[model samples]
Target: GVVGGRSVGVPGTVRMLELAHKQHGKLPWATLFQPAITLAEGGFKISARLNTLVAADPHLKKDPVAAAYFYKADGDARDVGVNLRNPELAAVLRRIAAEGSKALHEGEIAQAIVDKVQKHPTNPGKLSLADLADYQPKKREALCHDYQVATKDFRVCGFPPPSSGAIAIGQILGILKNTDAAAKPLQDGIPSADWLHLYTEAARLAFADRAQYVADPDFVQPPAGSWSSLLAPAYLADRAKLIGAQSMKVAQPGNPGAVKTSYAPMPDQPEYGTSHISIVDAFGNAVAMTTTIEDQFGARQMVTTSAARSGGFLLNNELTDFSFAPADAQGQPIANRVQPGKRPRSSMAPTLVFDKATGELLMSGGSPGGAAIIHYTAKTLYGVLNWGLMPQQAINLPNFGSMNGPTLLEEKRFPPATVEALRARGAEVREMNMTSGLQAITLGNAHGKKLWMGGADPRREGVVMGD
Candidate 1:
């Protein structure tokens, strides 16, 4: 999901999916309707996290409809079983499924959005009808690369720059693969303390590079090939030789961490609301798509006009993505000023890796979770490809992601032994509540049966089905 203010181009992707359902879908569009229709017909169950976020940030209560759906009769937000109603959204969905996508981009729905955005009260967006009228969803090839480690070749494919996760993972794994460290670092092998130290240092290096060079390709093109080269085996060998057991926190090269976080909002918070789907059509047209409202619930305002009920959600709060503080000229953070119309930086890393030889699809997966999405994917890939674990075992693994902050490790999913081992390594650990909801497909092939697999984030209440 691309969200934030500037990302408020056009938001009828759900309509697009309806028109372009994958050729291999097990259930028809009308069939899928029962699930959501049931929810909207009855009511949405307020999730634990949803309640917590509302309670912590009371400003959310300002949205009467949203608040009414979550809160009790008296006003307290629902705890777990509360039913949230959105007849309007349901009606909108029904319209798109029936009338086709044109109703969204050119009909009354589009007009409502164009109207609302032009008159926004707080941080009003200066979008022109022409901008909305000219918007179109474009497709591009997925970013990918290949590397061989331990005599086994691995192809890494992920959303390119603008998405730091894919590139960052490529850099880190590239370093890890070529390192002289023992192949198996986790399976009760390397002393836990020593291993965690090594992992943290490596993470630090990758993150530094990511922050410095990662940005929307539309704005500043990333030199993925050269950057990947410098971090390749030979370069990693030299860096690995310099890895002493001590922790070292360094600043990003081109952009320094010396830049302070500012109160001013980030520029391109194109928090495109995104959800992913992976399917290997029976006809062999494997499909992997990431769709979103751009940010959490999209631009928070909905319209209820008589012509039709449409997606009321505004653009994402992505404007907060750019540096809000002051900086020098060069667009380089005099404080990361976000320019209008620039695609905001994102962490969405939708990917599809292929079989090295035949070039058939190996794995297709993507997540909607923010920055951590990439880390979650890498861990799962590592488990299945490197450790020989089943897809389920890999998906069920405890999630751990750290980009210089307190390392976020899951609380109770993995074997307690592994958690205890890592905690003792002096790594400041943080336990999070949810996991990345990852939908994936692995093609069955000769080298390995083209297996189609999908793993949902344990933190979410959803399941996957395929042929």
Candidate 2:
């Protein structure tokens, strides 16, 4: 499923960070990279998770460079606590710091990316130098929705398409709120069966709409009217009415507007891999960024500079996110089909919350879970806003949600009675590992003083630090 150039799309990370830094950075450009450079040169210990992942990946060993970097002389993965150095990476960072974004976007570095992508031994790609040179980062308006829980209300904002995050989360939460789901309390400090039932059903409905309507906004238009129409109160109420005490098992897409759309629903495809960052500056301006290169280690092609001194970054296989068949069996074109200059559909959900009445910033959060990103973000937001759990406590909760399929519960986390109860109500319960990496920061008052609370997912090697 992961390989050469066709899988590759123009890598936007360098451009994305460059734009963000230009807008909000207060420190000098070079100073911001000191920590990373230092770590790369000085070496850092490999975490258990990284070691396990390296041993598990079947393809990483295929790349000679990756194999050399990640494995030991005996051909086993480098063990946990081993100090791994990356002089190559350190060299690249220095160039990027000195020349800014141009170092990677143009000239020598860009050419190497094109070569690695197109010249892969077994799986060649279509990316070219022109594509790399033409890449442009876009800045769009963040999508915000007003959410009410009992007497408290808040405004939640998330990235808009080519991300299906905000729309899906907004749709699910909106539909749930239309019913009595929000009013139901957590039983024994866990989401009650009633709440989970509604939440999972809403997830199926939202994912149904997601598969049918969401795509790169530059290429695809929303169904009835604007994108906001999908989350409209009346529309969500109509959609929520379909949830009738039992799991629908699988859901069909809804018509969110009056106008007829032209695209077919994209078929189920495996979507995975991402990293999230949530930061709040002294000025109180916050950022939630969800970055990825499609699957782990991107297209599995790492490129070095012309001189081969600096180690390179992974290229993204983002194009694979598009519907491969392009059309359904009935001949209707899929909305998320690949096209030149079109970005792929994504599930990265970077979020910001605000007090609706006073417009004060409340929280920032995001996660990496492929299509389940919607459920993870919704779970965290609901935990913080509705249950008043601290960010770490919310993130530590078990992960559960569906992508319009079987109702999945995190393996071994719930009581046996909980699984049987769902099955009795028509849900096909699947228990397996649902590793969700979530990061969050929230603001609240304690002991008559305002405090900043931060949380990181225990599933990965992430830590929250504040001064």
Candidate 3:
């Protein structure tokens, strides 16, 4: 399923980095690539994580070029600590460093990408040289909201539409804030049943609205007068009234902004893939960026030079983010349906939080888990801002929430009583692997000096390093 042309979307990470650097970079543009280029050219030990992923992947081995590079002659995945060198990738980065992003978007590298995509053995894609050449980065206003919890004032800002993150998270947290749930403190060192019940119910309601109205703003108009209409305090209060002593099982989208609409709610679709980066420059500017190839070893096809001399780079399968079914059973269109040149809907919530009064950066955090990203981000936000946990403590908290479906608690984390409590409230509970790769850094004091404390999810191999 992963190997094909349909999986690829025009790769955007390069353009994203380019835009970020253009706006906030203080170092010489080419200087930034030195470390990566050095690592690629000099050969680095293959990480245990990379080895395990290579061995676990069913399709990567089938690509001759990929197999030759990642596996031994016996076909076993290269062992951990193997000093693998990618002169080609290093070469690619060197070109980008010298020539800038256009090296990847145009010229020989771009041609190779197009050829590999359209000339695949079986699952060739439609990407062309023009699509790659035509790519342009977008600049939009950051979405920010204020929250007051027990006299603490904070402002949360996140990527706006095209990404359903900030809107959905704002809706869920806002709805919860409007309820008694806001005061349900942690019990026995964990979130109490009452707290989770209210939280998950609020999640269900938020996801229901997410399915209905969130999409690329270029193509789909916000349901209400503006995107903010959905997050209006009054609107959230009205939506919160739907939560009761028992679960609604599934909640339906509310009519916000009181606008007439014709779009059908998109059925829950599989959402996956991404790597999150949270950065703070010396100048105090911070960025939270979540980038992905849509799935692991995206597109299952690797791009390389003609003789496969340059090795390979994974292509993104992001186009799959679109609703496969353009219309619902009633013939009404889904707002997220695929269209030419439209950015697909995403749950990638790269978020930045700041102190309300001073406007000082408070936290930069995000995760990778498709639709569940909303819950992962919300948990971290609530953990750090509400319960006063350290960033790591918050990142370590068990993942739980709904995709407008059955209540899902991370398997083996919640006690049986926790499960029963939700079921007692009529929540259909399911426990399973909820692997979230969360990277976060919080600003606070240690002793007397200011610090930027970092937390990487215990669920993955992420690490925090800074000067």
Candidate 4:
């Protein structure tokens, strides 16, 4: 069931992913888990943004664990350099790993979760005990959308519905790759004002469609065929009509969406959600894992009773991501509306692009970003297949995004000269932090040497692994 707004639901990726790790992991779960487990237990110094968010919550001051985890003894938010932890949380996680997820829904963790929700305003208003008991992590059929990279045909494939990232972003890029506007991105060598304009316009049009139609495939069927089928030359022709080559601005909606912003009291505030891993081995199988606390530590509930100080974490408020207004003239509340057993919409596009020749996984990746995820993957993919930047170079190079909102330009990445150029192209430019905090890997022969490369985002302190 949905949490706050239309929470993505009990993440299915965890259950199936755990099974996948057990089946294919080269290292034990204990080993792969060392980083986050250590960070959470010992407590990494909380990010400034996290401290600010926790203090913003009305309930955080009311909850003792929350108070200790985020606030100092003086009863104020922790300063930037301070370290923190919830021994209770570390214990819950240990139990989750040893006993498995049943502990989360129907066992000890479940009882606490039920009690918390019963006492909490958000869940009590939305979900019931039966819904929690009946909830099941989803298993979906794999999805594929056709694409062409140069003369060769490639299929960008991933799990459908609940994970809409791969299909939506892949389709967007696929269409642009074939567009006349994009034919000579690297060949022209130097990018001009016109090139950046075309790219930004194309992205904005694609994002508009995404916000309108994409949702949990388990509960609502997407338009007709898959989004890939909708990415035809004819369709691209229609989409390009929305972009202009001169200064422009998208009008924001006069009112807040979904639940009216004023009436929607914020839940205990938490930091932005994040955690991810991408793995590909010799067997040609690859897994890209993106985990989160939903907020800095999720719902701010810690499992107080547990066996060891090894397990426990904040739960997610992903429920807040759903569309509040529900429906239009067409009865499509699930357009992002929370359903009894539906997954919420997400930008998590753990993707695999294949050569189809040896059936080898050429590139497998994904990132941890809220809504700007599409362009984060797009910029990287273009550099890999089209511009031929080394994996790290592609990921590290300055990033840009035009996902439905304003054209987001990173501070140092876009020079003042480029900003003037983009502004000349009819775009409303917003200088901001546009990081997907991504990790990526390529398993193939480069210059006849067998190479596997990985790069993590420095923005949020991630590490790449290769042997």
Candidate 5:
């Protein structure tokens, strides 16, 4: 159901990048696109990861264009290190570089997208050309919260809603702050069972709140009249009180002071696939960007500029991010339910950390793991800020989180004793592959000089590079 034209949303990457470049860009727009154009034209060798994904994807072969591009004449995935070229994408990129976002949003490219979505033989979509032409990227205020570790004070900033990332993370950290979690540090460079128990309990509470109140800010009002109310100390203190030595086993959402809402909590659903980038430039500018197409190979529908369809980009199934069941049995609508012109709620947690005392940019970090992104990012932040581990060390630590249900730990990473200890405390512990693609860069002092320390998650394909 997720892998056809019916799932595609109006593409917005070009428009969003253009908006960002209009404000802070120093280089020429065309010059900025030259590298991508070169790569598309000249091609790059396929990696083991790409080969595996292509081999495993069941829906990709259903699309003629995608099948031809990613597979061989015999229907086998291209071997690793095989050069793959996309001249059609190069042509599209060239037009975009020269003509700006208009090339994609107004003319031939936009028409192609509309035609593909509305005319799909099996499952068609309703995306219109007007939707593409009228699309506008938003610039929202970053959600920033004060965090103190030992004597060091810092400000953690994350993307505001239509992303539940920052609020959920803030709630998790805020709830933990009211508990004895900080007093129990890592044991032997790994999180102790004591610490994990508290952390997962906190995560459960945070996710409950997320399901209840977090959504596109334009469509839903924050609880208690302000987003900060969810993270208020008094509210968190009361929430933390629910965390006993034993797991709460599916925690419920807390009332943040006096709040009134008619919306129902969104039921849990599967979420998957995203990419993360953390970059610090020589000019002291930094960015933490998390981009996604909802599922692997997006809608499994490729949009090419030509009838030949030699090369193209995949369309996003972002509409699926909305709640499948729009309302509860009692008829109360869910906050994240799909609506006309509404942006879907996302778990993309692009984050930045600043030194409170000096106002210096301390870190740019984020991850890609669907709903688990909040936990992955929170883990890294806690590791660096609270536990005093390096960014790489934090990323290297085993991924664990509770999305208000079972406690998930990366398979084979935790000790057997740790697993048994969690089970003994009434937690439904499950060991699975928690592949987190996290990238981070933190400010550091090296030999009395300022340096930027960067880390890339070994769980996925990522690298740290600077000149």
Candidate 6:
């Protein structure tokens, strides 16, 4: 089963956060963790979402530590709105807050993590103490691209390689610009079938290039010696030419600058689970972050100092993000194939936008929908920048996207006519659960004063807050 130690990758959250705090944080390091500690120590009400996930999960109950904390004696999930505490997590947080990343990466916490992975009864992992201790977060250049809508130009920035986010998003939007999609506005607050047809076609082309070329930069080189080659205006225009009156159904990867890669395209596979956060602080600092554990309740294995403890956190099945089959039938290696010390290509696109002329911050946004993250984020950017919708209004629009296959729409959200319209174009349309947990905050003018606005996805339990 995917829910066990064999799926776990070395945890990186603590190290990543610590690195960010050290560089940009103004408050004392310990002060930053107090709220989470307080919440875990005191308790928080279980929401409908949590209760439903617990009840629905067939494997969560298999772990003794998780089964006890999240369920009743009868094995039913704890009731919604009931106060639940996780003192063990609180204890873990406290130690980390006090001792920095070392607490988790070097000593007691690291031991517990390694033990949980290596000693799993059914599926054991190879995580070692040295792996945890030696893990170092590397800061890479943010991929920024210039985008224009009508007369306004913006600079969109996103996470770089190892994350196929910004490059893919840039390609989609760039390709759309080469088409007439910009002229087709949203009909009644939702994207029209005409626009979606163009958008999904663009998505198919972009994803084709993604599976063919994107991977950890440390392992695979970008086509034509630069990632920007994929987003080049000339290249996008050529790609746009492929989209005719009908859907292409599936697209083949374009050779940017006529450059061919030795790697084979990764086959289509399931990608799942992540959360997004978009924040604009009082002092003008902003953060758009997307974190994940690769699957729901990730690996379904909980780790604490001891089984006697009632609280702990789940391990991530992040390694599974790699292409399971290392090579294709023709013997060409997949770019995202798993390798030691190599990060898997991901669709987590945490993004920020700035006014190109003045370099002023305009928006911070991102979404969690695994591979659909590219589409979710591109939709919000298009809605706000192209259609002039507010952040909340843009987020409230129904989620939709195509991952180079059948076009997907949020179930029951799109009109019947819209679905039939895509089908008429020889496109396969699937309306299912395209749940996107999108969060966005934009700088806007209100009553002739500068203001900050935030929006969260209503499909999931998220709320916008400000003091």
Comparison by TM-score, 3 against 4, better one: 3
Query: CA lDDT of 73 in candidate 6?
Result: 88
Better of 1 and 4 by lDDT: 4
Off by over 4 Å in 4: 1-13, 18-62, 76-86, 121-126, 151-153, 181-192, 225-227, 232-234, 241-272, 300-303, 306-312, 329-334, 444-447
| Residue 215 local lDDT, model 3 | 87
TM-score for predicted model 4 compared with the true structure? 0.80
Give per-residue CA lDDT, model 5, range 1-467, as digits (tens): 57677778777778999999999999999999899999998999998989999999888888888888999989999899999999889899999999999999998999999988888778899998899999999999999888877789898999988899998898888888888888998888899999999999999999998898888888898887888888787888899999998999898888885556668889999888899999888888888999999887888888897778756988899988899989999999999998888999999999999999888999999999999999999999999989887899999999999999999999999999999999999999999999999999888898999988889999988898877
Q: Candidate 3's residue-wise lDDT over 1-467, tens digit each? A: 34677668888778878988998677898999999999887888888878988999988877776777788989999999999987778878988899988999999999988987888788888898899999998999988888878898989999889999999999988999999976788776678888999999999999999989988988888876588888888989999999999999989999886545579999987888688989887788787889888887777777776465536587888888888889999899999998999999999999999999999899999999888888999999999988999999999898999988899999998889989999999999999999899999999898999999999988877889899
lDDT per residue, candidate 6, 20-93, as tens digits? 99899899999888999999989999989889889999998988888888899899999999999998998889
The per-candidate count of clashes, in order, stands at 50, 4, 1, 18, 0, 0
TM-score for each of the candidates: 0.77, 0.97, 0.96, 0.80, 0.98, 0.98
Tens-digit lDDT track of model 4 for 1-467: 23322232353445665666766667766455556566667877767666676677765555454565567778888787677765666565666566665555566666665555556545443444455556655556666655566776666666566655665675567556545654656423334455666667667666555565567765555554454444555565555554565633442111112321112111111124566678876665677667664554555553345444222444466765665556544543436665666666666767777776656577777777766666677777777766666667678767676665567777776668778878766677888876568788875576999788877777666788765
- Stretches of candidate 3 off by over 4 Å are 258-261, 306-310
Error of 2 at 106 (Å): 1.3
Candidate 6, residue 460: how far the Cα is off, in Å: 1.1
lDDT tens readout by residue for model 1, 1-467:
12223335445355446545653356666566666766776776778867775667544444444455445657776686666666666775666666656556666766766766665555445666555555554444556767564566767777665556677666666655655433545554212445555655566666655655565555553443233443455655555554454455442332212222222212222222357777667667766666555556555555544443322333445544444443444434522335555655566767677767777777777776666666667666766666655556666666776675455666664455655555665456667654577776665445665556666666665567865
- Candidate 5 contains a number of clashing pairs equal to 0
Off by over 4 Å in 2: 306-311
Between candidates 3 and 5, which one is better according to TM-score? 5
Q: Can you rank all candidates by lDDT, best first?
A: 6, 5, 3, 2, 4, 1
* Candidate 3 global CA lDDT score: 0.87
